[model samples]
Target: MVTIIKGKDRAEYPEFFTQLFKLRYKVFVEGRGWSLPTKHGLEIDQYDDDEAIYFLDVNEHGIIEGTVRITPTVQSSLTADYFSHLIENGQSPRSSRVYEATRYIVRPSQKSRDLNRAAKSRLLAALTQWCLENDVESIQTVIDSNTLPTFLELNPKVLPMGLSYPYGGGRNTHGGGDCMAIRWPISQEILECVRLYGDLSLLHAVDAISSENIGEMIH
Candidate 1:
């Protein structure tokens, strides 16, 4: 199930971050080769301040499967602070209605590649649910070509905001290839799209409920 952990409540769950940050270290630091500020096998960045909220999809055992980070544009965001040049004419998302989504990662423990990918779909669905719950108007993020396909699938007409540029080591793209900043309009349609494409059985507890036993929520 997806667990909602806002910045304020983060301190309440130390073990959660321990597992989640280790996953981030594996995915972003070791795997993707992003030069993030990582130490003690924890991928912690400045953007992980109180302004950020984390959506984590964990198994019934509390093991993190995948996670996403949403930073309010009204405060500091990945786009506004660092990747502004990727925005058209430097007009990054800065209003409260818009949010910046980042740090999407799926744990590599899944031996089945197909199951791992399907779990990522569930993570996307969870992120969409968060946007819907928070009344978010638009969601912006920086991603490389590797993730463009999934975003395209989630938003049928998804497109880049401006020309692609190099960032702190793009993911899965060749030689840290061009990373694009994208914005998607938030609406019920997004939730519908996720429902249409995500693993429906994993939809339980992505938004309102964060049951310790996801199996219980499924039925």
Candidate 2:
């Protein structure tokens, strides 16, 4: 199942955070060779602040198998702060109803392609559910060419914000590929499509936590 962890409640789950960061280190640093700030084998950045929310797909053993980060665009976000140039006409989304998603990673522990794809679909469904509940209208993110097709398959409403640029490779340490910024509109119809494509049930796919019931889960 997927677990929702808001930044304010991060202190309650230190071990989970530890594993999450290490997983990110393994994926982005060791695997993708991204030149990100690191300390003691943890991959972290300025965007991991109180305004950020994390979605974790944990296994039965409590290990984080897949994860993603969401930050409100009204505050600092990757798209607005860093990739504004990628947006066509230089109009970056900045509003409470819009958010930026980043740091999507899935553990490579399992070699089965089907398992990995299922995990990714689960995360996408969970994100769609949360956005619908919270009134988030859209998601802005930078993704490589390899991932764009998958996004388009899930939701035809996905729109590219600007032209793709060659990232990573050579001197660039952010992994190799042509990456572009895109915006995805959120709606009940979109959520249904995701749930159907992922074969996920709303009752079992996500366990969305909030500040009100966070203590109950912790205890």
Candidate 3:
């Protein structure tokens, strides 16, 4: 299952945060070899401010499976603070309805390689459900062309905001550094895709919904 977590709630679940940060460290640092700051086996940075909200994917045992972070575009978002040039008109978004999704950390289940695919869909479904329920109209996230297929499995309509640009001013680990900022609309298509692929029902009630479709839809 996935849950929306806030910074203040960190105190109540130290183990969860520790697991999340450890996963982040494994992905971004040890795996990707990014020189990000780490402390006591936890990968943390400035953007993990008080305003940030995270949707965490955990198994039945509460072990972290994947995690995604979001923050208001009105605040210092990844695009506004660092990747503004990728935005159209060279202006970063500033609105409550729009949010930046970053630090998407995922670890595949050791038992099944295909389960990782479903895991991604599940986490994305949870995030999309939360956004639609809370009136978030759009979410901004970065994507590498190589991983575009993986993301497209979540929502077919996801499109880039502007021309591809070098992320981190070309200093990123990706040799070409060709990254694109994408916008995913909070729409029915995403909900349907999530419902079918993730084997999940919409958290927000939808008209003509039933549990029978869930079993029939799972791939």
lDDT of 3 by residue, 148-212 (tens): 77677668887777777765446555433577778888876788886666543432243235553
Write the candidate numbers in order of decreasing lDDT. Answer: 2, 1, 3
Which digits, one per residue and each the tens of the lDDT, describe model 2 over residues 1-219? 999999889999999999999999988899987789999999989989988999999988898888999999898677777767788855656888998899998664575665666777789889989998999999888998668988887788999989887776632444677788998899999887776655534423443434456788764
Candidate 3 residue spans exceeding 4 A from truth:
89-91, 111-113, 168-176, 199-219
In model 3, the Cα lDDT at residue 218 comes to 72
In model 2, the runs with Cα more than 4 Å from the true position are 169-174, 200-219
Q: Highest TM-score: which candidate? A: 2
How high is each candidate's TM-score? 0.81, 0.85, 0.81
RMSD of 1: 9.6
Cα lDDT, model 3, residue 121: 77
Model 1 lDDT per residue over 1-219, tens place:
788899878889999988888888888788877778988899999888887899888887778888889898888687777878887855656987888888887773565655765777678777777888888888888888567887786678565888887665554453376788988777778777766655545444343456565668665
- Please report the TM-score between candidate 1 and the true structure: 0.81
Q: Please rank every candidate by TM-score, starting with the best.
A: 2, 1, 3
TM-score of 2: 0.85
Predictions in order: lDDT: 0.77, 0.83, 0.77
